[model samples]
Target: MKSSVIKIALILLGSYLIGCQQRPHADKLQNATTKKIIGYIAGWKGVDTSAVQAEKLTHVNYAFANVIDGMVTEGEGRFDQDKVNIQKLHSLKSRNPDLKILISIGGWTWSKGFSDAVLTDDSRKKFTDSAIAYLIRHDLDGLDFDWEYPGMQGDGNVFRAEDKENFVLMLKSVRQALDSLEKVTGKHYLNTIASAGFKSYLEVNDLGQAQQYLDFINIMTYDFVGPGTDTTAHHTNLFNPNLNGRSAAQAVFDHVEAGVPIEKLVMGMAFYGKSWKSVRPGNNGLYQPAVWNSTHPYRNIQGMVGQDGYVRYWDEDSKAPFLWNQSDSIFLSYEDPESIAAKAEFIKTHNLGGAMFWEYHEDSDDGELLNALFQSLRK
Candidate 1:
């Protein structure tokens, strides 16, 4: 009888422990389905907070706070303006209390000091302390590191091989500091990074270790066909089977292979388009050589489509759209409502974390692209 009683007790204990383990997993699964819509707001563009559609976004990463002399600071000569912009961004919380505003430091231009800032423990602490202080002073929710390209030359920024490890260490220190702050303020803070979409970036850094310290990794999936590229292609295509080129689908796969969890990966979209001049007329100007290239905001691209001899064409394989102007030999690659809906479907099908876009103002005043994202992701 005692043996049977003990056996029953063992079974009950096992069931209790199994239930305990499954509870957290169930919560994680529930949170995973709640997608995030992150938008990068350019503070330099003079953020008109009133115009910002805060209700549609889950997070807004303000670009950018700069790293100066091993410390975090507002951009040089723009401190006053940055302070006002941050204040304005904070006011947006009134519209959507759940909205999270993060300060993104070290953009393409301001990433020069990252190498020296996190070179040693003391420097890392200094940088971390200043970052935490900035957050506290601004009453911000978190920090987003946008180190252009660690261990790689980006916009003539200083870089070293050690940057690969230091980058992880930097994130760890900041995460620890944020945790300590949470203990005092009773509020949780987030830590995220804007990672490059290219595979070369994964080769240099260890995202497997880095993700442990991050809440989300926002990949810049656009700019695949950047300036000086002789061939014109999709800058932010969801898929590209015909040509072996960069695509958002490929980038997400690379990140997953690089050890980033699919639940923490936020797919990036472009709110603007890339334009090339003097392109060959074959394939509706797809994969053709061009002499000059420039950027066009979505607001402007909307007006240009089907006007002034510009014809819009869709590549079914790539799941992308483009504009061809045979008279001007101008080819444009960009995302429209159709492409945005396709990407949103991709995100849902793959169970990705969510979506992020660059520069809020690039979208139309009527919030065309943002509405597509909200309807697809939020609704």
Candidate 2:
């Protein structure tokens, strides 16, 4: 009888321990050893989606659905063109059933309208209604708001101090609308935002409130150093050892610390490179005074590698690569297979959501950068 009582007690204790065990958090979810791989397909790029290697991606966001006077415009002026492109994106599901296409609205060029759209309850309703109708009409799986910013006019958008709270109110309204439609259709719709990586941007908006409504926030980690800057540095470095400026890791921590769940943040990688000309030769033309030159798509850069006096060098501290053409006094900073792999490792190490790039057209036909991300994340 004593032995049987001891066995029963042990069983009860084991049951209690099992019941107390915690489930995995969203960020730490064990999703087949790889997180979601999202890629942006810029609408104006005129990319032929049929040529896209759809199976490599889990989600493709259609770029730049214009917002006009508080109304969501499916396309800026080329409505038919957008329809055709969206159709092509949806058709990719035949090849990869898991692929989801989302409509991204209010990019840098078109974000001006967002200020007025979310200003009032009535305006928010109009915008929310337009968004849902647009998604349903296009048969899209989700919506991504890429308003360059809220409560800021730097992107040629109107601003108000109230934008901070208004932004959250707008997102909540949209989420509620989407949920209502979902209940009727018995389908899920994802709602996300393309957020700025800078800490200043995070402070202006209520990300904690916004996060509750968003499926995830896509952090634009690239472009930290662009043509407007005076000095040269890695615009998308994973870690800033020297602390010259913003790093991807810093941006991730800022957002997560600001109340966004780690799993709800998707880091953005640039598929193109930012370049500078007339760079001083000191420090191998890095962090030197230089004039910002035009950006080079990875496809174009791939062709320039090891040619035209161009030589690529890797920075061990930043975990990024740069190209210097000593003959032309040109310096280029961008992501490559190695830097991208490092970023993938950062994502895995931090247990954050997977990687995303600017657009599919910027990559080589061989899909070099995309392949690197997919392979690295899989491991």
Candidate 3:
């Protein structure tokens, strides 16, 4: 009887330990309290700081720090603008002292060099050294790599099958460099990446292995449906009710299942919308072939909501909003406060890291979407 009882007690203890391993840490809960509201600041565009509510954001990522010859540097003729924007961003510290400013290296257009820059150990170290120096020189908090992809073809970028493994090595090298610098400066510098949202990129890189050397992964959940598609679909839907497998929720699940902790996944939101002309005139003009129209900033979409041949429509299936102009055969897929609120709720429900958006200046002076996120998450 004594032997049987001891075995049962051991089993119970083992079960408890397993459960503890799955539970979230106390720091995760604290971090989620102010859940990061990261916004990308476009350095090339003219910014209006008065329109931004600095207090609502936790971090501001300055977009597109060019990578040249395996080093991070200013784009050609962009030194003046880059310096001014960095200063302007730093000035906002007076309003929100806790705001972290990071320099985002490589974007869709500038990611071509990443393949060669991170190919070998020596090259990766060179890139890491330059990135750290650039951060210190700009008085930035950290660095973000928007590499588009590692082993996939992206916007004319070179790719090799070996990149699948090299990408992991590159991140490990970078994390080490960041750690060394942290020791010297006595400050914690965040290392993050702008990851591809779909499974294509997921299949190439080992996210579980890479997550060890990173802070958080910002999934670019937008552009799932773009001008290149034959049918108009929800570009940034929270849920994919139709089973099309192209929604923010699906991407989150995919990453988590692939071994990335949910606490390190930040759902991406788009501040702009994609419009298409010549859409079929039924079913609210959704999932129909249409001619691609210009990508409209949220500010532009706001004005056209109830005017200019645009009538807003809510999609219950995708849990998103799209504009369908029946008279003009036009359709626009975008996000608003209601949609953003749903995403915030989703984040809390799933215990996600936080939410991030593409660019900041697209929002109105009132910061409608950002306000929705701030209120929803805080509440």
TM-score of candidate 1 relative to the true fold = 0.91
The parts of candidate 1 lying over 4 Å away from their true place are 1-33
What ranking emerges by lDDT with the best candidate at the front? 1, 2, 3
> Which window of 10 residues has the lowest lDDT sum in candidate 1?
24-33
**Candidate 3: residue pairs that collide:** none
Write model 1 residue lDDT over 246-312, tens digit each, in one string. 8999999999999999989999999999999999889889899886579999999999989999999
Give a tens-digit lDDT track for model 3, residues 248-361.
Answer: 999999999889999899999999999888898788899898888878888778888889768888988788999999998989999998899889888876788899998888
Residue range with the least summed lDDT across 10 consecutive positions in model 3: 23-32
